[model samples]
Target: MATDTDFIHRVGDLAPALRSGGQRLHRPLLLLWALAQAVNGKPRQQPWSAIRASVTPLLATYAAAPGDQAAVYPFWALRNSNLWEVEGSEELSLTSDGRRPTLSVLNERDPLAGLLAEDHDLLRREPSVAARTASSVLLRFFPDVMVDLARDLDLTTLLAGGIDGALRPRVGEPYANRTAIAAVYGGNGVGGITPLADGILSVYSDDKGPYDDRRVAGMDWIAYTGDGLAGDQKMSGGNRSMSTYRAEQRPLRYWHKPHGGVFTFETWVVIVQCRQRWGVGQNREPRREYVWILAPVPSPLRATWPEEVKEALAQDVADDLKVHDDLDVDLPPVALGDPQGAMTDMERYRKLSAAARRTAAGRTDRSKLTKVERYVRSTAARQAVILRSGGRCENPTCLGHPTELTDKGDPLLEVDHVHELSRGGGDTPESMIALCPNCHTLKTRGSGRQQLRQALLVRAKALHRSFAGSQGEDEKRREPTTGQPL
Candidate 1:
């Protein structure tokens, strides 16, 4: 008899060890998928189609090679893992040894299956613990591919405490401050729409799209855009209503669409940086708006932001950074002028330099830069870098997939200096670009670092120019301009 903790440990310890001998990951992937669905509030007993809907993508992502048909191997084989069980599965033909079902059999039967009762209970009662434990296990066994796929799939919402994270306040705001912002906008805000009884966003509908169908075109990667291009027709690639929502500074609400079904985001994304954009509304009015970026809310802040989700996301960044930094290559070392220098610690040096300038000017009262002033100076540049990259790693190879989630359940990406900041590059978007940790570390510290930097700068600038031309030349609008944070 396993204790509850013991059971969970065993679940994590599961390896896809079929008697045929080669190590496989399908079991672990299936286990995590089952746990994720449990966290998402699906019923304890799930049909095979439900599992298929989820696991097929995992197979596509984590399979050793493209077009592998091994997804069904786990659907039947996981019964041995003890964390999973199947019901009504007799219709399928078993292997010659009678231990597992053939893939063809699974395809024909498509029977119902689910997590074991006790396993489901544990996951349901302690979703956070289960999510963290499972993620830790996956991270330990399948770090790079699993972590990246989890983010790209938006599967972190299970660990994210579901809708609770969306209800949380933004940085520097009181909890539930959305109510205040809603009041400010009156009927023009997210609250202006009839709230869902459960306050969760619903499915996408065809009525909402210029797209062709309402099929739940399962997303391979979540996409993000910056404030500067939020209104650009070709940039947003969305419909009029989405544009209207941004124009109003509104949090998203699930709504009807013409082609894509009733579409909705997984969470309530708040504005991080706002600016005026051209041709946003029905009348094509220019309006004040902000670009949305997903960032993990800082810790010590209390909101629906889950500690587990933050830890998992942070771990993903760490793992990605490690992969790039640990790449085996012999490259000439770039000398660090001060190996121990801390960027944050250098702020003190900046203040001292400012004080000396004030003294030389015959001014006695030297006020150091305030947090708000620093924020004002950097927000425009940050927004520009994020917008230019189209909310994905600017490394042309990584595509638009997010490698991690923000506290708000948005994509997490780091902004990097395309030109070395220490080498006198200005803190402007032109000098910076957005990158995932792996790509950033490679560009800054890996072999061929200078060539990579030059390449990225070229791509970043070209992307900016292309985005501007597509949006009727909104280039001048993205220039460093500051406004008070909302």
Candidate 2:
């Protein structure tokens, strides 16, 4: 039950108290951009990922205050106005104040937000109203940049009382081959990369092509090799397109040619991570290349993804946070210490562990492990341990949260098992402990694995006891004190 008039009223009154201090264009800019989307007949529900990549730069450009500008602030705050609607609010765990989702949660979870659907529809139908709302934003917040903004967004169409009817580019259905794909999508169709529809794509094949794309087993994402056959890969060209921070982000498309069949659109993707590592180029010379870690664009709400895929995606996302420790994320929960939730999560991991063992039953050795998404371990168990670790390495030798923290202001730690799960260890909190990536690798694959394991076993036992004692204290504090007023 929304109308263009209601939205116009709300839009005009956005953050009025804050506006009195200085003209802040963050929310107004978002509104204008959304209005433009409506004028062009785009979908009402815009993904946060898309909005981040699109509006963040604009916020940096237009905001009056240096410290208060961020796409996340406006995108999350606008819902209070009732003009904007978010698709994934319930799933958000929120902050300690029970206010907003954390930056990490907002970044990792692909929540959809934009103008209310009814308002979007009405705005699209009545261009004059849309134009009026936009004019008000210009007159109030960013009058100086109205002409520049108009040029950038091509707002002339809307201001002239018309819809541009801009069509979103799509990857349609399967193509006969790379050739067939290029014919329609307009790429060279020779290598892994295809430039089409304002996005970059990567193809995976067994053939010895220029790009040696590999989807490792038990992993949902692909380590997409950067373009160029020789030397270290640079952060230019198609490689830039895959990086979210480099001002080259675009919609990521996953095009697969399975069993050497016709090329098919797999799913839309967003880069979970990107890393440069030592490798051999196509010509077999020593080189390093950027590996763009691509995960499926998560659903706006609850994921309908395959179980294995979802599991691996969860692991990759955690890995992504670890790798980019300093990257800023918005707000959500690793802190409430919800024991019941942790218990349920741990039980789910137990099943995943057994399933993983069954899937790899016939594999001769670890080296021969098939490139199918099956893992004999649980990311949930790992995460539970990480939660228990409180962000610092659990090793007694390194017992404090690191100086460096993940964007969400949490410590980066890896869950390590005191006894190997593969060697018949239980999948419970006591069996696993969290450590920093350094200690984890040293314990699992280093020379003194036995010594580290023994030390971790002792430390983990003490850690759990401490956690239990702390929980009891917290409960006692929450309960009424003896002889207190009831």
Candidate 3:
């Protein structure tokens, strides 16, 4: 029979011995052993059922010896039992136990523990474990990793395509692996190991300062071109093919070429068409407008183009100018700034002009305008009526708000007529007003909105008929149908 001293020694040796055996014990068994050692050699016996109830499911078993059997027989319980020890029980009680058994046992045997333990140790050592933990929690609940990555990819592609990096800020460093991971894992950042086989990875070096003269120092550069934007560069998944390239390194500068003209004149123009029908408020007219913009082409032009190509382009521009007096309205000017400079500038100018025009169009206050004055006035007046209607559909049941702002902060409010203009609804403030984009689209597409309206009207008519029928029945029951007060 084991003596009390021997039992104590055995209890002390259990964890180290188990660690040395190199046996991969099930976690539940390990926990039971730890808890058993924690309550070793007490006077009063712990109820087996209570112990089992406390640790069942998590621990495989819970057993204890009675009286002196406690010293000789090895007891078993849960690893969590070390959290408490029983009071008044001279033997072991969990209520008296302070340290949790699993942690304590693991700590004691740490030096001798094998591969599984090493893996746990590695997790503890990771610098990003805390951040990864928080990220894991968010990902677990809301799986939007791929959606976010797609958005990132779009922005990176735009920037790599010579779009303004400042205007299109990049997210975290574009990792080649992340793209493949996203693709294979349903864009949620999990599973799959196949490498992407077909894409181009472009690297962009962000200038540390506004001026190119200042070198990007030791700061870790932001990466924008990788698998995220270009898909898997190594794999051909039949998805969209993507490529990235660095923008022109030169700063924005205008290049001017002298034409045979007495005055050095440059001009820009913008023309926009409202693609959707149903103009401002009740008006169902498509608004079409254009603007003329001018800036002198810079003097002392330098071209990266081959001499022959440059000469050909210059001749082409000259020919076009001779054919059309208003170059701004007739053709897009040759971007003389650098490679792809003209296209980039034109796009930027278009966005800026659109924003300005939208603001001007929405304003209720009258302002001066050179051209398209009548059109602008009409747009503003219609917008004013739409705004006055609480910026929602006039229809009581149409739960649609009128104005919505775009990502770039432009208002996207549309005026919707209560009745279709084609059906003889005259263009008047009373006939039309503001409606949300969704409602306008629904109404235009001949979708369920019209059906829903018809259904509601039908339901209302039926309800009225039912009430009238009930009143007639009541009159018949109360008196002869010859009109008598009940």
Identify the leading candidate in terms of lDDT.
Answer: 2
Error of 3 at 299 (Å): 29
lDDT per residue for candidate 2 within 309-384, as digits (tens), equals 4454455555553332111111111242344444543343333333332343454343211232222123334444
Q: lDDT of model 1 at residue 353?
A: 25
Cα deviation at 213, candidate 2, in Å, is 2.0
Best by TM-score: 2
- Model 1 regions lying over 4 Å from their true place: 1-3, 17-22, 65-68, 89-91, 158-486
lDDT of 2 at 86: 80
Model 3: weakest 10-residue lDDT segment is 268-277
Q: For residues 1-486, could you state the per-residue lDDT of candidate 3 as single tens digits?
A: 322222222222222113332322233233222223222322222433333333333222112112321211122321222312223223332224542223233223321211122222322343232122222221211122312322322222212322212210122323333344334212222211111111111112222211111111111111111122211123122111111001101111111112231211111101111011111111221222111111111211122323432342344345442211111221121212222343443333233223323433333422211122223223332433333433334434555554455332324446544455344332333334455576567656745767744443333223222323453234235433442111
**Each model's lDDT:** 0.45, 0.56, 0.27
lDDT leaderboard ranking: 2, 1, 3
For residue 208, model 3's alpha carbon misses the true position, in angstroms, by 28
Using all chains and alpha carbons, the TM-scores for the candidates as numbered come to 0.32, 0.33, 0.18
Give the alpha carbon lDDT tens digit for every residue of 1-486 in model 1: 334455544654464453443347777777777777777777777766667766777676675523435566787878876777778666567889987777666667677788888778777787555655555445433544654666654566654543223232222332122334334211222321332221221112223222111111122111222223223333232323244333322344322332323222223332222222212222323322322222222321224435543443344345441211111111111111222245321232223223222222322321211211222224344544554554578788664445575443334677766775334343444456788877877886889788887788767656655544433134335433552110
Query: Residue-pair clashes per candidate, as listed?
Result: 22, 8, 23
